[model samples]
Target chain A: MSEVQLTSDLIQWKDGAADWEEAIRVSAAPLLQQGNIAESYIDAMVENIRTLGPYILIAPNVALPHARPEMGVSEAGIALTVFNEDVAFPAGHDNKTQTARIFICLAAVDSDSHLSLLQGISQWIDNSELLNRLLEASSKDEVKDLINQYS
Target chain B: MKILCVCGMGFGSSLMLKMTADKVIKKKGLKATVEATDIGTAGSTPVDLILTNNEFASQLKGGKSEVRAVVNVASEEEVEKAINDFLESQ
Candidate 1:
Protein backbone atom coordinates (compact mmCIF):
# COMPACT_ATOMS: atom_id res chain seq x y z
CA MET A 1 0.00 0.00 0.00
CA SER A 2 1.66 3.16 -1.15
CA GLU A 3 0.04 5.95 1.02
CA VAL A 4 -3.65 5.29 0.69
CA GLN A 5 -4.82 7.25 3.71
CA LEU A 6 -6.53 10.60 3.43
CA THR A 7 -6.20 11.15 -0.30
CA SER A 8 -5.89 7.49 -1.09
CA ASP A 9 -8.05 5.95 -3.78
CA LEU A 10 -8.91 9.45 -4.94
CA ILE A 11 -7.39 9.25 -8.41
CA GLN A 12 -8.21 6.70 -11.05
CA TRP A 13 -7.92 5.94 -14.79
CA LYS A 14 -10.60 4.41 -17.01
CA ASP A 15 -10.90 3.35 -20.60
CA GLY A 16 -14.18 5.23 -20.98
CA ALA A 17 -17.65 5.78 -19.56
CA ALA A 18 -20.92 4.82 -21.23
CA ASP A 19 -22.18 8.38 -20.86
CA TRP A 20 -21.79 11.50 -18.76
CA GLU A 21 -23.73 10.02 -15.87
CA GLU A 22 -21.50 6.98 -15.84
CA ALA A 23 -18.49 9.20 -15.96
CA ILE A 24 -19.49 10.89 -12.70
CA ARG A 25 -20.21 7.54 -11.08
CA VAL A 26 -16.82 6.23 -12.09
CA SER A 27 -15.09 9.37 -10.89
CA ALA A 28 -16.95 9.40 -7.58
CA ALA A 29 -16.42 5.69 -6.86
CA PRO A 30 -13.19 6.28 -4.99
CA LEU A 31 -14.73 8.92 -2.76
CA LEU A 32 -17.73 6.76 -2.00
CA GLN A 33 -15.58 3.74 -1.15
CA GLN A 34 -13.40 5.87 1.11
CA GLY A 35 -16.54 6.95 3.05
CA ASN A 36 -16.23 10.49 1.81
CA ILE A 37 -19.64 10.55 0.16
CA ALA A 38 -22.93 8.64 0.12
CA GLU A 39 -24.89 7.06 -2.73
CA SER A 40 -27.25 10.03 -2.91
CA TYR A 41 -24.33 12.34 -3.50
CA ILE A 42 -23.58 10.56 -6.74
CA ASP A 43 -27.20 10.86 -7.83
CA ALA A 44 -27.16 14.54 -7.03
CA MET A 45 -24.11 14.96 -9.20
CA VAL A 46 -25.89 13.38 -12.14
CA GLU A 47 -29.19 15.15 -11.49
CA ASN A 48 -27.42 18.46 -11.25
CA ILE A 49 -26.01 18.21 -14.77
CA ARG A 50 -29.29 16.96 -16.19
CA THR A 51 -31.23 19.86 -14.76
CA LEU A 52 -28.69 22.64 -14.86
CA GLY A 53 -27.06 21.62 -18.14
CA PRO A 54 -23.37 20.78 -18.56
CA TYR A 55 -22.28 23.75 -16.53
CA ILE A 56 -19.80 21.35 -15.04
CA LEU A 57 -17.77 21.50 -18.23
CA ILE A 58 -15.49 24.16 -16.84
CA ALA A 59 -12.66 23.64 -19.28
CA PRO A 60 -12.27 22.42 -22.83
CA ASN A 61 -12.06 18.68 -22.16
CA VAL A 62 -12.73 18.59 -18.45
CA ALA A 63 -15.89 18.39 -16.38
CA LEU A 64 -16.22 19.23 -12.70
CA PRO A 65 -18.80 16.89 -11.22
CA HIS A 66 -20.32 18.42 -8.12
CA ALA A 67 -23.59 19.20 -6.40
CA ARG A 68 -25.03 21.11 -3.44
CA PRO A 69 -23.06 20.60 -0.24
CA GLU A 70 -26.10 19.45 1.69
CA MET A 71 -26.80 16.78 -0.93
CA GLY A 72 -24.98 14.04 1.06
CA VAL A 73 -21.37 14.90 1.67
CA SER A 74 -19.73 13.81 4.90
CA GLU A 75 -16.59 15.85 4.40
CA ALA A 76 -14.83 17.78 1.72
CA GLY A 77 -13.15 15.34 -0.66
CA ILE A 78 -11.91 15.36 -4.26
CA ALA A 79 -11.58 12.68 -6.92
CA LEU A 80 -10.14 12.79 -10.41
CA THR A 81 -11.06 10.17 -12.99
CA VAL A 82 -9.44 10.35 -16.41
CA PHE A 83 -11.06 8.74 -19.41
CA ASN A 84 -9.08 7.74 -22.47
CA GLU A 85 -12.06 8.61 -24.62
CA ASP A 86 -14.50 11.47 -24.34
CA VAL A 87 -17.59 10.99 -22.18
CA ALA A 88 -20.73 12.58 -23.58
CA PHE A 89 -22.24 15.33 -21.42
CA PRO A 90 -25.37 17.22 -22.27
CA ALA A 91 -25.64 20.79 -23.72
CA GLY A 92 -22.37 22.54 -23.02
CA HIS A 93 -22.59 25.38 -25.50
CA ASP A 94 -25.33 26.26 -27.98
CA ASN A 95 -27.18 23.01 -27.19
CA LYS A 96 -24.29 20.87 -28.27
CA THR A 97 -23.32 18.03 -25.97
CA GLN A 98 -19.79 18.56 -24.70
CA THR A 99 -17.50 15.64 -24.07
CA ALA A 100 -14.56 15.78 -21.69
CA ARG A 101 -11.86 13.22 -21.09
CA ILE A 102 -11.23 14.38 -17.52
CA PHE A 103 -13.88 14.24 -14.82
CA ILE A 104 -13.03 15.82 -11.46
CA CYS A 105 -15.86 14.79 -9.14
CA LEU A 106 -16.18 16.89 -6.02
CA ALA A 107 -17.96 16.29 -2.70
CA ALA A 108 -17.99 19.52 -0.75
CA VAL A 109 -19.14 19.55 2.88
CA ASP A 110 -19.66 23.30 2.80
CA SER A 111 -19.12 26.42 0.67
CA ASP A 112 -15.47 27.01 1.51
CA SER A 113 -13.76 23.69 2.26
CA HIS A 114 -13.13 22.84 -1.40
CA LEU A 115 -12.06 26.26 -2.71
CA SER A 116 -8.35 25.59 -2.41
CA LEU A 117 -8.73 22.23 -4.10
CA LEU A 118 -10.78 23.83 -6.84
CA GLN A 119 -8.14 26.48 -7.38
CA GLY A 120 -5.56 23.77 -7.97
CA ILE A 121 -7.89 21.74 -10.14
CA SER A 122 -8.97 24.69 -12.26
CA GLN A 123 -5.37 25.82 -12.72
CA TRP A 124 -4.47 22.27 -13.67
CA ILE A 125 -7.21 22.38 -16.25
CA ASP A 126 -5.59 25.48 -17.70
CA ASN A 127 -2.38 23.50 -18.21
CA SER A 128 -2.81 22.07 -21.67
CA GLU A 129 0.40 20.07 -21.52
CA LEU A 130 -0.57 18.38 -18.28
CA LEU A 131 -4.08 17.75 -19.54
CA ASN A 132 -2.70 16.22 -22.73
CA ARG A 133 -0.29 14.04 -20.81
CA LEU A 134 -3.06 12.94 -18.47
CA LEU A 135 -5.14 11.82 -21.42
CA GLU A 136 -2.28 9.61 -22.54
CA ALA A 137 -0.92 8.52 -19.17
CA SER A 138 -0.82 4.75 -18.71
CA SER A 139 -1.06 4.07 -14.99
CA LYS A 140 -3.11 5.41 -12.13
CA ASP A 141 0.09 6.09 -10.18
CA GLU A 142 1.40 8.13 -13.07
CA VAL A 143 -1.76 10.17 -13.12
CA LYS A 144 -1.73 10.46 -9.36
CA ASP A 145 1.77 11.81 -9.41
CA LEU A 146 0.81 14.46 -11.92
CA ILE A 147 -2.33 15.46 -10.00
CA ASN A 148 -0.44 15.57 -6.71
CA GLN A 149 2.19 17.79 -8.26
CA TYR A 150 -0.51 20.35 -8.94
CA SER A 151 -3.02 19.88 -6.12
CA MET B 1 -19.38 46.73 -5.15
CA LYS B 2 -20.73 43.21 -4.76
CA ILE B 3 -19.87 40.39 -7.19
CA LEU B 4 -21.45 36.99 -7.40
CA CYS B 5 -19.72 34.03 -8.94
CA VAL B 6 -22.18 31.61 -10.54
CA CYS B 7 -21.96 27.88 -11.22
CA GLY B 8 -24.28 24.90 -11.44
CA MET B 9 -24.29 24.54 -7.70
CA GLY B 10 -23.20 27.80 -6.04
CA PHE B 11 -20.57 26.06 -3.99
CA GLY B 12 -19.18 23.90 -6.77
CA SER B 13 -17.27 25.81 -9.43
CA SER B 14 -18.28 29.30 -8.43
CA LEU B 15 -16.00 29.17 -5.45
CA MET B 16 -13.06 28.76 -7.79
CA LEU B 17 -14.26 31.66 -9.91
CA LYS B 18 -14.79 33.64 -6.77
CA MET B 19 -11.19 32.96 -5.78
CA THR B 20 -9.85 34.18 -9.08
CA ALA B 21 -12.20 37.11 -9.14
CA ASP B 22 -11.28 38.02 -5.60
CA LYS B 23 -7.58 37.95 -6.45
CA VAL B 24 -7.98 40.09 -9.54
CA ILE B 25 -10.36 42.52 -7.88
CA LYS B 26 -8.01 42.91 -4.93
CA LYS B 27 -4.91 43.21 -7.10
CA LYS B 28 -6.60 45.95 -9.10
CA GLY B 29 -7.41 47.74 -5.85
CA LEU B 30 -11.10 47.76 -6.62
CA LYS B 31 -13.73 47.86 -3.94
CA ALA B 32 -15.76 44.73 -4.53
CA THR B 33 -16.88 41.64 -2.66
CA VAL B 34 -17.03 38.32 -4.49
CA GLU B 35 -19.42 35.63 -3.35
CA ALA B 36 -19.89 32.09 -4.66
CA THR B 37 -23.40 31.01 -5.54
CA ASP B 38 -25.28 28.37 -7.46
CA ILE B 39 -27.40 29.11 -10.49
CA GLY B 40 -30.72 28.46 -8.78
CA THR B 41 -30.32 31.17 -6.14
CA ALA B 42 -28.21 33.64 -8.14
CA GLY B 43 -31.07 35.38 -9.94
CA SER B 44 -32.71 36.97 -6.94
CA THR B 45 -29.55 38.35 -5.36
CA PRO B 46 -28.71 41.69 -6.92
CA VAL B 47 -25.09 42.61 -7.14
CA ASP B 48 -22.93 45.02 -9.10
CA LEU B 49 -21.54 42.26 -11.31
CA ILE B 50 -21.78 38.53 -11.93
CA LEU B 51 -18.81 36.43 -13.01
CA THR B 52 -19.54 33.02 -14.47
CA ASN B 53 -18.58 30.66 -17.23
CA ASN B 54 -20.15 30.76 -20.69
CA GLU B 55 -22.74 28.15 -19.71
CA PHE B 56 -24.22 30.11 -16.83
CA ALA B 57 -23.62 33.62 -18.16
CA SER B 58 -26.63 33.68 -20.45
CA GLN B 59 -28.78 32.37 -17.67
CA LEU B 60 -27.70 35.24 -15.46
CA LYS B 61 -28.13 38.05 -17.95
CA GLY B 62 -30.56 41.03 -17.88
CA GLY B 63 -30.25 41.46 -14.16
CA LYS B 64 -29.42 44.64 -12.30
CA SER B 65 -25.81 43.55 -12.23
CA GLU B 66 -23.67 43.28 -15.33
CA VAL B 67 -22.73 39.76 -16.52
CA ARG B 68 -19.39 38.69 -17.93
CA ALA B 69 -19.02 35.19 -19.36
CA VAL B 70 -15.56 34.19 -18.39
CA VAL B 71 -14.12 31.39 -20.47
CA ASN B 72 -11.42 30.47 -18.02
CA VAL B 73 -12.35 30.95 -14.41
CA ALA B 74 -8.84 30.04 -13.30
CA SER B 75 -7.11 32.75 -15.29
CA GLU B 76 -6.66 35.90 -13.30
CA GLU B 77 -5.63 37.71 -16.46
CA GLU B 78 -8.97 37.09 -18.09
CA VAL B 79 -10.78 38.06 -14.90
CA GLU B 80 -8.66 41.16 -14.52
CA LYS B 81 -9.56 42.22 -18.02
CA ALA B 82 -13.24 41.78 -17.27
CA ILE B 83 -12.96 43.88 -14.14
CA ASN B 84 -11.04 46.60 -15.97
CA ASP B 85 -13.68 46.62 -18.64
CA PHE B 86 -16.31 46.97 -15.99
CA LEU B 87 -14.45 49.90 -14.46
CA GLU B 88 -13.85 51.54 -17.84
CA SER B 89 -17.54 51.27 -18.68
CA GLN B 90 -18.57 52.81 -15.39
Candidate 2:
Protein backbone atom coordinates (compact mmCIF):
# COMPACT_ATOMS: atom_id res chain seq x y z
CA MET A 1 0.00 0.00 0.00
CA SER A 2 1.02 3.59 -0.53
CA GLU A 3 1.51 6.26 2.12
CA VAL A 4 -1.53 8.16 3.34
CA GLN A 5 -1.50 11.92 3.84
CA LEU A 6 -4.28 13.35 5.96
CA THR A 7 -6.62 15.76 4.17
CA SER A 8 -7.44 19.19 5.49
CA ASP A 9 -11.21 18.68 5.62
CA LEU A 10 -10.71 15.89 8.09
CA ILE A 11 -9.09 18.28 10.52
CA GLN A 12 -11.01 20.30 13.08
CA TRP A 13 -10.04 22.66 15.88
CA LYS A 14 -12.01 22.78 19.09
CA ASP A 15 -11.83 24.68 22.33
CA GLY A 16 -12.34 21.81 24.81
CA ALA A 17 -14.39 18.75 25.68
CA ALA A 18 -16.42 17.99 28.75
CA ASP A 19 -14.43 14.79 29.24
CA TRP A 20 -12.44 12.13 27.43
CA GLU A 21 -15.39 10.23 25.98
CA GLU A 22 -16.65 13.43 24.41
CA ALA A 23 -13.16 14.09 23.15
CA ILE A 24 -13.08 10.75 21.29
CA ARG A 25 -16.53 11.45 19.94
CA VAL A 26 -15.46 14.92 18.87
CA SER A 27 -12.28 13.56 17.31
CA ALA A 28 -14.08 10.84 15.35
CA ALA A 29 -17.13 12.86 14.27
CA PRO A 30 -15.46 13.82 10.99
CA LEU A 31 -14.66 10.24 10.05
CA LEU A 32 -18.22 9.18 10.75
CA GLN A 33 -19.60 11.92 8.54
CA GLN A 34 -17.20 11.00 5.75
CA GLY A 35 -18.33 7.37 6.01
CA ASN A 36 -14.74 6.30 6.51
CA ILE A 37 -15.71 4.76 9.82
CA ALA A 38 -18.91 3.74 11.54
CA GLU A 39 -20.23 5.12 14.81
CA SER A 40 -19.36 1.83 16.42
CA TYR A 41 -15.71 2.62 15.86
CA ILE A 42 -16.04 5.68 18.05
CA ASP A 43 -17.63 3.65 20.82
CA ALA A 44 -14.94 1.03 20.49
CA MET A 45 -12.20 3.63 20.81
CA VAL A 46 -13.75 4.95 23.99
CA GLU A 47 -14.30 1.44 25.29
CA ASN A 48 -10.67 0.54 24.76
CA ILE A 49 -9.51 3.38 26.98
CA ARG A 50 -12.18 2.55 29.54
CA THR A 51 -10.98 -1.04 29.76
CA LEU A 52 -7.28 -0.87 28.96
CA GLY A 53 -6.48 2.53 30.44
CA PRO A 54 -5.10 5.56 28.57
CA TYR A 55 -2.69 3.75 26.28
CA ILE A 56 -3.58 6.04 23.37
CA LEU A 57 -1.44 8.92 24.64
CA ILE A 58 1.74 7.79 22.88
CA ALA A 59 3.51 11.09 23.50
CA PRO A 60 3.10 13.98 25.86
CA ASN A 61 -0.09 15.97 25.05
CA VAL A 62 -0.77 13.78 22.04
CA ALA A 63 -3.07 10.81 21.45
CA LEU A 64 -3.85 8.38 18.66
CA PRO A 65 -7.26 6.96 19.46
CA HIS A 66 -8.11 3.82 17.50
CA ALA A 67 -9.90 0.48 17.56
CA ARG A 68 -9.77 -2.83 15.69
CA PRO A 69 -10.75 -2.42 12.03
CA GLU A 70 -13.09 -5.36 12.33
CA MET A 71 -15.17 -3.33 14.72
CA GLY A 72 -16.41 -0.76 12.17
CA VAL A 73 -13.78 0.77 9.94
CA SER A 74 -14.99 1.05 6.36
CA GLU A 75 -12.05 3.00 4.96
CA ALA A 76 -8.54 3.82 6.08
CA GLY A 77 -8.42 7.43 7.25
CA ILE A 78 -7.41 9.72 10.09
CA ALA A 79 -9.38 12.54 11.70
CA LEU A 80 -7.55 15.12 13.78
CA THR A 81 -9.01 17.30 16.51
CA VAL A 82 -6.85 19.92 18.17
CA PHE A 83 -8.13 21.11 21.49
CA ASN A 84 -7.19 24.42 23.06
CA GLU A 85 -7.22 22.82 26.49
CA ASP A 86 -6.08 19.29 27.16
CA VAL A 87 -8.61 16.52 27.71
CA ALA A 88 -7.85 13.82 30.24
CA PHE A 89 -8.10 10.05 29.85
CA PRO A 90 -8.61 7.69 32.73
CA ALA A 91 -6.23 5.49 34.79
CA GLY A 92 -2.93 6.74 33.41
CA HIS A 93 0.50 6.06 34.89
CA ASP A 94 1.22 6.65 38.61
CA ASN A 95 -2.47 6.76 39.52
CA LYS A 96 -2.78 10.05 37.67
CA THR A 97 -4.76 10.89 34.56
CA GLN A 98 -3.21 11.33 31.11
CA THR A 99 -4.19 14.36 29.04
CA ALA A 100 -3.76 15.37 25.39
CA ARG A 101 -4.26 18.47 23.27
CA ILE A 102 -4.06 16.69 19.95
CA PHE A 103 -6.26 13.69 19.22
CA ILE A 104 -5.73 11.78 15.96
CA CYS A 105 -8.41 9.17 15.42
CA LEU A 106 -7.14 6.33 13.25
CA ALA A 107 -9.28 4.00 11.13
CA ALA A 108 -7.37 1.25 9.40
CA VAL A 109 -8.85 -1.16 6.89
CA ASP A 110 -7.20 -4.06 8.69
CA SER A 111 -4.69 -5.00 11.31
CA ASP A 112 -1.82 -4.42 8.90
CA SER A 113 -2.79 -0.90 7.91
CA HIS A 114 -2.65 0.67 11.37
CA LEU A 115 1.12 0.44 11.24
CA SER A 116 1.19 2.89 8.35
CA LEU A 117 -0.96 5.36 10.22
CA LEU A 118 1.25 4.75 13.23
CA GLN A 119 4.27 5.55 11.09
CA GLY A 120 2.78 8.88 10.08
CA ILE A 121 1.97 9.94 13.61
CA SER A 122 5.35 8.80 14.85
CA GLN A 123 7.17 11.36 12.73
CA TRP A 124 5.11 14.29 14.00
CA ILE A 125 5.64 13.12 17.57
CA ASP A 126 9.34 12.44 17.11
CA ASN A 127 9.84 16.20 17.15
CA SER A 128 8.42 17.57 20.36
CA GLU A 129 8.87 21.11 19.07
CA LEU A 130 6.62 20.41 16.09
CA LEU A 131 4.04 18.86 18.39
CA ASN A 132 4.12 21.89 20.61
CA ARG A 133 3.77 24.07 17.54
CA LEU A 134 0.78 21.99 16.50
CA LEU A 135 -0.90 22.88 19.76
CA GLU A 136 -0.01 26.52 19.17
CA ALA A 137 -1.12 26.56 15.53
CA SER A 138 -3.87 29.08 14.83
CA SER A 139 -5.70 27.44 11.93
CA LYS A 140 -6.49 24.04 10.45
CA ASP A 141 -4.34 24.76 7.42
CA GLU A 142 -1.40 25.45 9.69
CA VAL A 143 -1.96 22.15 11.48
CA LYS A 144 -2.23 20.33 8.15
CA ASP A 145 0.87 22.03 6.84
CA LEU A 146 2.89 21.07 9.90
CA ILE A 147 1.73 17.46 9.70
CA ASN A 148 2.32 17.37 5.94
CA GLN A 149 5.85 18.60 6.51
CA TYR A 150 6.62 15.47 8.50
CA SER A 151 4.11 12.71 7.64
CA MET B 1 16.59 -11.64 22.68
CA LYS B 2 12.85 -11.89 22.04
CA ILE B 3 10.56 -9.01 22.93
CA LEU B 4 6.80 -9.09 22.87
CA CYS B 5 4.94 -5.77 22.61
CA VAL B 6 1.58 -6.71 24.05
CA CYS B 7 -1.59 -4.61 24.15
CA GLY B 8 -5.27 -5.17 24.81
CA MET B 9 -6.22 -5.95 21.20
CA GLY B 10 -2.74 -5.69 19.68
CA PHE B 11 -3.91 -3.04 17.25
CA GLY B 12 -3.12 0.50 18.32
CA SER B 13 -0.39 1.31 20.82
CA SER B 14 1.34 -2.06 20.63
CA LEU B 15 2.26 -1.45 17.01
CA MET B 16 3.93 1.84 17.98
CA LEU B 17 5.97 0.05 20.62
CA LYS B 18 6.98 -2.61 18.09
CA MET B 19 8.07 0.06 15.59
CA THR B 20 10.21 1.90 18.13
CA ALA B 21 11.66 -1.37 19.42
CA ASP B 22 12.57 -2.48 15.92
CA LYS B 23 14.31 0.81 15.14
CA VAL B 24 16.11 1.08 18.50
CA ILE B 25 17.20 -2.55 18.46
CA LYS B 26 18.49 -2.28 14.91
CA LYS B 27 20.35 0.93 15.71
CA LYS B 28 22.03 -0.77 18.65
CA GLY B 29 23.34 -3.57 16.35
CA LEU B 30 21.46 -6.20 18.29
CA LYS B 31 19.80 -9.32 16.99
CA ALA B 32 16.25 -9.78 18.24
CA THR B 33 12.85 -10.92 17.11
CA VAL B 34 10.10 -8.56 18.17
CA GLU B 35 6.39 -9.05 17.74
CA ALA B 36 3.19 -7.29 18.80
CA THR B 37 0.41 -9.50 20.13
CA ASP B 38 -2.79 -9.40 22.11
CA ILE B 39 -2.87 -9.96 25.85
CA GLY B 40 -4.18 -13.53 25.57
CA THR B 41 -1.35 -14.62 23.27
CA ALA B 42 1.32 -12.68 25.12
CA GLY B 43 0.76 -14.68 28.29
CA SER B 44 1.27 -17.98 26.46
CA THR B 45 4.30 -16.98 24.38
CA PRO B 46 7.66 -17.12 26.09
CA VAL B 47 9.89 -14.09 25.69
CA ASP B 48 12.63 -12.34 27.67
CA LEU B 49 10.53 -9.29 28.46
CA ILE B 50 6.90 -8.34 27.91
CA LEU B 51 6.86 -4.61 27.06
CA THR B 52 3.71 -2.54 27.35
CA ASN B 53 2.30 0.57 29.02
CA ASN B 54 2.16 0.75 32.81
CA GLU B 55 -1.56 -0.02 33.04
CA PHE B 56 -1.36 -3.40 31.27
CA ALA B 57 1.85 -4.33 33.06
CA SER B 58 0.07 -5.48 36.22
CA GLN B 59 -2.26 -7.88 34.42
CA LEU B 60 0.69 -9.30 32.48
CA LYS B 61 2.62 -10.07 35.65
CA GLY B 62 2.88 -13.49 37.50
CA GLY B 63 3.68 -15.07 34.16
CA LYS B 64 6.97 -16.44 32.89
CA SER B 65 8.20 -13.18 31.33
CA GLU B 66 9.28 -10.02 33.08
CA VAL B 67 6.96 -7.06 32.34
CA ARG B 68 8.34 -3.56 31.76
CA ALA B 69 5.71 -0.83 31.98
CA VAL B 70 6.82 1.81 29.52
CA VAL B 71 5.62 5.38 29.99
CA ASN B 72 6.00 6.54 26.41
CA VAL B 73 5.72 4.15 23.46
CA ALA B 74 6.87 6.68 20.84
CA SER B 75 9.92 8.00 22.66
CA GLU B 76 13.20 6.52 21.38
CA GLU B 77 14.97 7.59 24.56
CA GLU B 78 12.43 5.76 26.72
CA VAL B 79 12.47 2.62 24.54
CA GLU B 80 16.24 2.55 24.20
CA LYS B 81 16.58 2.87 27.94
CA ALA B 82 14.09 0.06 28.46
CA ILE B 83 15.93 -2.15 25.97
CA ASN B 84 19.39 -1.41 27.43
CA ASP B 85 18.13 -1.84 30.97
CA PHE B 86 16.65 -5.21 30.11
CA LEU B 87 19.73 -6.35 28.16
CA GLU B 88 22.13 -5.36 30.93
CA SER B 89 20.26 -7.39 33.57
CA GLN B 90 20.35 -10.52 31.42
TM-score of chain B of each: 0.94, 0.93
Itemize residue pairs with steric clashes in candidate 2. Answer: none
At residue B45, candidate 1 shows an lDDT of 91
Candidate 2 global Cα RMSD: 2.0
Please give each candidate's TM-score. Answer: 0.89, 0.92
Estimate, for each residue in A24-122, the C-alpha lDDT of model 1 and write its tens digit. Answer: 999999988988899999998888777878898777787888887778889777888889888987775467666888888877776555666676676
Write candidate 1's Cα lDDT for B1-90 as tens digits.
998999987776787788888888778888888898888889999988888988788777778889888776777888888888877888
Per-residue alpha-carbon lDDT of model 2 for A17-77, expressed as tens digits?
A: 9999999999999999999999888999899888778778767888888888888988999
Worst 10-residue lDDT window for candidate 1 chain A reads A1-10
True contacts kept of each: 0.72, 0.56
Q: Per-residue error at B45 for model 2, in Å?
A: 2.2
lDDT of 1: 0.80
Residue A74 CA displacement from its true place in model 2, Å: 0.8
DockQ of 1: 0.64
Worst 10 residues of 2 chain B by lDDT: B53-62
How well does candidate 1 match the true structure in TM-score terms? Answer: 0.89
